[model samples]
Target: MEPGSFWTALIWAIVPMLLLLAAIWWVDRYEKEPLRLLGLALVFGGVLAPAITYALDRAFDIATSLSSQQIVPEPSLGVGTPLVEEVVRGLAILAVFLLVRFEIDDLLDGLVYGGIVGLGFGAAANFVGIWNTPSLGSDTDSSLYTSLISQLNHVFYGAVIGLALAAVRRREFPILLGAIWWVDRYEKEPLRLLGLALLFGGLLAPAIAYALDRAFDIATSLSSQQIVPEPSLGIGTPLVEEVVRGLAILAVFLLVRFEIDDLLDGLVYGGIVGLGFGAAANFVGIWNTPSL
Candidate 1:
């Protein structure tokens, strides 16, 4: 692609992602979180986090006899990658949680923070993906499709992560403590159950995405062979994924009646999960790009 064309396509690809981020921010209208933290999270997601993962992968390669091909082919959307990436991404939220436990106050606050972190992670990852990919000699459609899919997938994944983390924190610690406190004092039987449910759902999201991708691939192959109708996102696959995620959120909400006052906690927790999911996805997306 010409330099001019590449610039145009890049701009187009970015605008919608920004709009989506704005929409998410608008939806979370309670506390307007500082853009500085959000920016930091994005930096962490796009650069520091991916760098750390890359370093770890390299270390694994050096410590063992694993070939690049063997390591590179590790499932991108599976239990293994998500497990590792989620922990790394969660660190961003954990950092904030530690410092601001006094301000968190409610479940929804958790969701908001989680979403912010996830949005930052997703944006950084998407930016990297777009920046690294060649313009494909001016075929903007491919780039646009890639951007759209990347954005939506990251957003969804982040949301789920936010919800899961929120649920867990709600159960584990309902009140803030000073440095000397060794344990949480809240008895949260309900939130504990909700946390378990969130864990189960968060674990399942990637599995479902993988299954749907595979199913779509198979259906497309069959369609090409004239054996079935064309397979697309509209074939009930995306809906199924959404339903599963919704059920997970509902399970947590139903189980935990922590009090309306604690809504911020939920938001913050959900946001953290989203941040982790988005950061993980972003890391993989950048790492797997044609160029490092």
Candidate 2:
């Protein structure tokens, strides 16, 4: 690699991630975390955690390569990387959480802090990836795109774990929500409203929909006295679920029209409603899971 290539590749790698980190900072609606602590989290992710991950990765690579057995099912370098990365990164999150537990006012706070660290980690990882990319001859566009997308995957993983940790600590809600929550660009939506939307989708919509389906089943049973597939369980589910979520979105739209200025803003609400509905569905699928 050329002497200047490292700096160039590193710049290409970290800039986009820095912009994302900036966006996360912007969306942190309620309270801004301490900068010093945030920086520490960044260092832990970009420097400390990655260093540990690299060491572990190398060892794991050697061990897995030497083993003839398919120890990990997928058994590639990638299979165990998430476990190694998340553990080190989770510790980074834990340090920040411990140092500034009082600052974490809400779940979003956890999202922001954890996201920052994740972005930092992603940037470093991307730099390594880009640095190692076999020169695709003159054009670096492909390498840059691959690195950015891969960086985003890491960011999502890190953010989700962070969000889950926050949910666990507060015991407020489940992490059934998707990483799309971060897509609210400005992330101005209140977490409580989002939670409410999820509840509406999960509980009320399902209840009404299920009732209507049961009525349909009884009516069909009495008249036809026959059925294939028992009316296909929740036959009106999609329509009813959409309508219920649409109502929730409309209610939220009316309530917070100011926060949702554009289509993307509206989408954030819609997405949350969808996620809430999904979370509830998953919980109903597994009744014993209290976390759900």
Candidate 3:
């Protein structure tokens, strides 16, 4: 590759990853973690977690083939894909949690970890997507644009999911402990509502982005029909996704009234899960595409 092209590809890879890390940092404004651990989490979540997931996926495939359940073969989507993938990703989170339990001081920690995992996943996926595009030689501009947009979208999705997991974990713990009993009786109700808000906000970010993109396309088409054409902003979907993600973080604040520790834990955990999924998806995308 030419030096210019290599630099462009490297930038394309690093920028989205950095933006994701920054967003995760912003969400955990309450309890700031050491930069070293954060960087460590990012490296592991981005690099190692994906490799582990890939290995597990292959192992599962072999296991399924070896099993002799001829009378009742497992449905591909129901029994095979979702179950195996979820387990593989969940194990990645579990491994990190075990090794760095001390680092995960609060719900927000969960969000951070989840975000790191998602970032790693998104980076890997974007690299593959960019590398596989046949238009790279003929339509470099369009291909680069597409890669950037996809990377941002993936990062936003991962962050939202990370936030949700963190908040839920935080709430579950206080309930398990005797902390809630000492607080006002009405506190728990509000916390539960907050958790729900986070869940919905996180899950809906991608759908909202999809809707906005469709709306933008329609608007652009209508504009072209008139004498004068309106310019495309390209900001609608990302803005909406960010709003939803921010709301999730806000929900975490309102729902978890205990010490900041639980919040950090939830934040990091959610981030790890999102990261793992993003990485797995990236790997799949790479494998499916034509090599550079």
Cα distance off (Å), candidate 3, residue 227: 28
In candidate 2, what are the lDDT values of residues 138-174, reduced to their tens digit? 4333335435555665676677667666765776544
The segments of candidate 3 whose C-alpha lies over 4 angstroms from its true place after superposition are: 1-7, 54-87, 136-292
lDDT for model 2 comes to 0.62
lDDT digits (tens) for residues 1-292 of candidate 1 = 3222446445644676578768867866777656665565456655565555545546543211111111234334245454554555667666655555555545555656666555555555445445544443543333344345455655655554554455556665454332112122243334454355446455554345446545655221112212232234233433444454555555555655453235444543344333333444455435544532
Cα lDDT tens digits for candidate 3, 1-292: 3112545556767887787677777877888877876666666656665565556545654222112112222343245543443344445555655666677666557767766766666675555434433332332343354455555654544444444445445554343222322222333334454345435444443344435545764221112222222234333423444454555445554555352344334444334333333343344435544543
* The 10-residue segment with the lowest total lDDT in model 2: 218-227
Best by TM-score: 2
Whichever of 2 and 3 has more TM-score, that candidate is 2
> In candidate 3, how many Å is residue 96 off?
1.6
How many angstroms is residue 65 displaced in model 3 relative to the true structure, after the best TM-score fit? Answer: 24
| Candidate 1 error regions (>4 Å) | 1-13, 54-79, 134-138, 141-143, 168-292
Best by lDDT: 2
Between prediction 1 and prediction 2, the one with superior lDDT is 2
Candidate 1 weakest lDDT stretch, 10 residues: 62-71
